[model samples]
Target: MKYLEGIAEFCAVADVGNFTGAANKLDTSVAQISRKVASLEKQLGVKLLQRTTRSVSLTEAGTQYFQQVLPALKVLEDAQLAVSALQASPQGLIKLTAPVAFGEAFIAPLLNTFMQKYSGISVQCTFSNEKLDIVEQGLDLAIRIGKLEDSTLVAKKLATRHLFVCGSRDYFKEQGQPRSIEELKEHSLLVGSQPYWRLFIDNKIQSIPVQGRVRYNSGNALCSAAVAGLGIAQLPGFYVRKALASGQLIELFPEYKDKQEAIWAVFPSNRNVAPKIRLLVDFLAQHLVSDS
Candidate 1:
């Protein structure tokens, strides 16, 4: 273990076939590498290299030593590289994709914090409600909510996006709060484009089909319309927590509220994922979880 550095230098010089080339590749002086290899031979109590004034070749012992230790040395080197890469603050451009509203409202601010901590990192964020093929699009990471359909990507659950069946206080008082799922059909339902809301009931997932006078794809639109006394809409807690707390919107069905679900950071599998993606995923997960 103590002579690992020496072994590494010896391997490098042997592999490159010249001390100058090895020194250049290792970013060190040839003299230092030569000394380390000499030290390694002394420590091993055997001559491992046969060096000429102009060129160097492995001796029979050196050849045997190089063949055995070379691969293990490379493995040690790769391990060191991985550790060093992890220790350094992640750098490079990280392209991220997310839902339009969630990215702007939640993820963007957290990304600002991430950028401040990792000044070397640059980010390009695209906000679209549409589901994207992250690998084909060459995205570094993506934020997805609800149930994931793509099994190819690795999904790290960031936080629970607690949803609410909500209405304005005025509308709830006038229409009367629905005490059960069966009564929800009687009320004026405001539809998101998805047209269905999933809830957990009796240890099972229940999908409720709904209709409304007004329909919109955007969560913000649904939230804003509901605030303006449109009707009941199922929306995420982040979209309406402040409103509910401020009495702008009233959360309905406290007894039956089981609509909390997860947000995930998804990325494609790679042989060796760059530090940039790792940092972002970790930072996002930490920030989102802490905030929640």
Candidate 2:
């Protein structure tokens, strides 16, 4: 590290052509800069600078060495400056993952606004329902909905995900509405990923087995099918909020509304969270917690 430290001083003296000039540029004493250059030359077993009372110039070997090492030193300095800039302000690409439906409906738009606010920052999002390893996948953060499993990752709750049983007005008009959990079997069902509907009944959690004509792996797709009057579907509020508001879908068993799980911004359990990731999480929490 000592030898490495002198490289910068040598480069500075070579560039400025004098120890005093290099010292002023680096905010150090001329004697310190001179000693650093001398140490660097002694370590290299070759004189790197020719010094006089009036001026300083590089030896032939110094010129060749400077040409070779200056570019690499410049690269290192640039990297340090980039990191310092990030510490001062949020910037860089945030590699993120989220559930497809939520990502498209909410996170994508939220991130769009965040990027507009901080032009130095950009985001790459992977929308999938699959649970990915945040560390192994090298993702900066993940937006997760539903009960989080026990893990080593750090999670910040953004909001509560409320599950709703919903069906199109047309579907209910044709098949009639379910008055209770037991009556769900009598109606056509649209199931996503899970084959059973989980609900809170009689002050206890119940999982009712449901068979549907259309089964999908995506909540968005199931919500679409339900809106088309295919069947009743269990979906998160974010998926059906607009449909319910537009009178295209009706919420079923409103008294049975269950807090299914929570939405979370999850990241690796690192000692220090990156500023970009922390700021993004806070931004999301600010917008989503109220709506949830």
TM-score of each: 0.69, 0.68
Candidate 1: segments with Cα more than 4 A from true spot? 1-87, 290-292
lDDT of each: 0.80, 0.82
lDDT of 1 at 273: 54
Give the clashing residue pairs of candidate 2, or none. Answer: none
**How big is the positional error of residue 164 in model 2, measured in Å on the Cα after superposition?**
1.3
* lDDT tens digits, residue span 1-292, model 1: 5867588788777766788766754557889988999899999999988888888898999999999997776676568658758665666777779999888988999989999998998888889988876644557678999788888778888887666889998888788888888999899998986788777778776788999898998888888998998799988887888888899998876655654578998876531356677778888888785223
Candidate 2 lands at a TM-score of: 0.68
- Ten contiguous residues with the weakest lDDT in model 1: 268-277
After TM-score superposition, what is the CA distance of residue 53 in candidate 1 from its true location, in Å? 59
> Which parts of model 2 are misplaced by more than 4 Å?
2-88, 289-292
